[model samples]
Target: MAADRRVAEGLEHLKEAEKCMKTSFFKWKADYDGAASAYTKAGTCFKSAKSYDQARQAFLKAAECNVQNNVMFHAGKAYEQAGMMCKELNDLNRAAQLIEKAGHLYREHGVPDTAASTFDRVAKLLEPTNPQKAVDYYLIGSDITECEDRPRQAADFQKKAAKLLVRMGNYDRAVEVLKVEKKFQIEGENAPEVSRVTVELVLCHLARGDFVAADKAYKDAYGIPGFTESDHCRELAELLDAYDENDQDRLSSVAARPMFKFMDNDYAKLARGLQAPGGGEGGKKKKAALLDEGIEEGMEKGQLENQEVGGEDEDEFEGGLC
Candidate 1:
């Protein structure tokens, strides 16, 4: 429980800071820098008191003041702090939106990597409830990463986005994203990565019930030297053949063959649904659950892991306090 005295103290500090900021901005010859600094102090006090919602508001006000003062870099940095507070409060959607704003501001300030990272966070936050939005943000982030000359990191984000798209059953878009990755991967250098992407593409096609497309993807994947020899690859081939033959029993057997340890093999569930008594409603529910869980994993993992990259930058934020 929050201490009542601490909460009241925090609110008092916040109100006093707001009063000072207004006095500075409106009556003191528009001293925007002073107002921004006061707001940053208010945010610091709120954060120290564990009043995260108030801290977020204070930080956002600081950002607005910085923007008005033409200190765009500080504005972006202030928004980044506000986003962190929202994230801490479990208001992920609000955090993502603020982070996206920070990303654009950072990009405008010529901080490519920071901008890319902020966009990545936004994508991860949106992945579960709005995968399409996640994919869009990931694309933007990956392009920025590429521009920052971090091709491998860019490829990783693209692959992540593609996987989310596949989980969302947007196979066509997944294929497109993977194709972009393919263009970046050097032959014999990232060959395994390329092969993995191809495997994912084949699975996406199969999930979409495009047997011919799946077969084509499988064949294309095999054309890469040493690609079709893995036991996993062999199982994928058999699965494709079964799907092409319209043999539900064979498809079910092949899809359940334990080749996919990383992803849920929904093909087996789909086949079983066809063979079920009540028109596959149970299978449909399972498939939907699988999609939800997969996307949720991506979203939650990003928040858990990705936040560690630049945490040491807190000292810079400390310097902004009045």
Candidate 2:
């Protein structure tokens, strides 16, 4: 009964807020600020009454009213509240959308730190269900941090995005994000982090069955100062060697290392699935077949060469010049 009373009170406040938006001869300008305040009250009451849907609608109305009043910070906050209500209602998709809008509003209001944080929050929330969208938001957060000259923070966001992409089996995009993350680490003068990211880049290539790119990534890491001296470089070297030698046993050992195990969940999953190029019994059979083909071709060439020499000798003998 108390909750029902609160709901009725919320509806009355909502009506009052709506009435404030209507133009009248006595009011030359709409009372947007007053409407926003009333709508915010309505939202709070509805939320307190556990009416999430009505609370969400009220908060969204507050956000629009704040926007019309040119109060962007308040508008962003209102949108954030609406997003929380959506989360309470288990409407994650709408929650993500509203929170993203709040982030954009915060950015436009010249509060980039808040915007970046908002973006990051929404991205993490969406990670389990919509990884692609999570990657997009993470990248947006990375860009915002980068623009703020926060290289370390930017690299963190990029790393998160890269891992998600790797999980989705989007190795190409993962490599791209890892490259950007490496650049950020470089700009931050973090040699160890750069090396670590480079290792991830190489693993991404390898996971995609692109040994050439993986080798190139390893070689490219040498250009980064101190990368050659880092443990990551050595790990990469062993991993590459195992793949090149098609040594499945060695590959498994390398992939099971503590470093691989300590990586993010997605990267760890990738590492666990790493296989030597031309791995397994099937790969061994293929290698044996190729070797046999090469040997047979070489023998045929040798035989032809001998036949030519014999013919030359016969010609010389026929001419009495042997």
Candidate 1: pairs in clash:
none
Per-residue lDDT of candidate 2, residues 122-152 (tens digit): 9999999999999999999999999999999
Q: How displaced is residue 136 in candidate 1, in Å? A: 1.9
Report, for every candidate in turn, its global Cα lDDT versus the true structure.
0.74, 0.91
Report the Cα lDDT for residue 35, model 2.
Answer: 95
Kindly report which residue stretches of model 1 are placed more than 4 angstroms away from their true locations once superposed. Answer: 1-28, 87-91, 186-188, 223-225, 264-322
Candidates in order, TM-scores: namely 0.71, 0.82
Candidate 1 CA-lDDT value? 0.74
For model 2, the stretches where C-alpha displacement exceeds 4 angstroms are 1-9, 223-226, 280-322
List all candidate RMSDs to the true structure: 27.0, 9.3
- Model 1 RMSD in Å is 27.0
Clashes of each: 0, 0
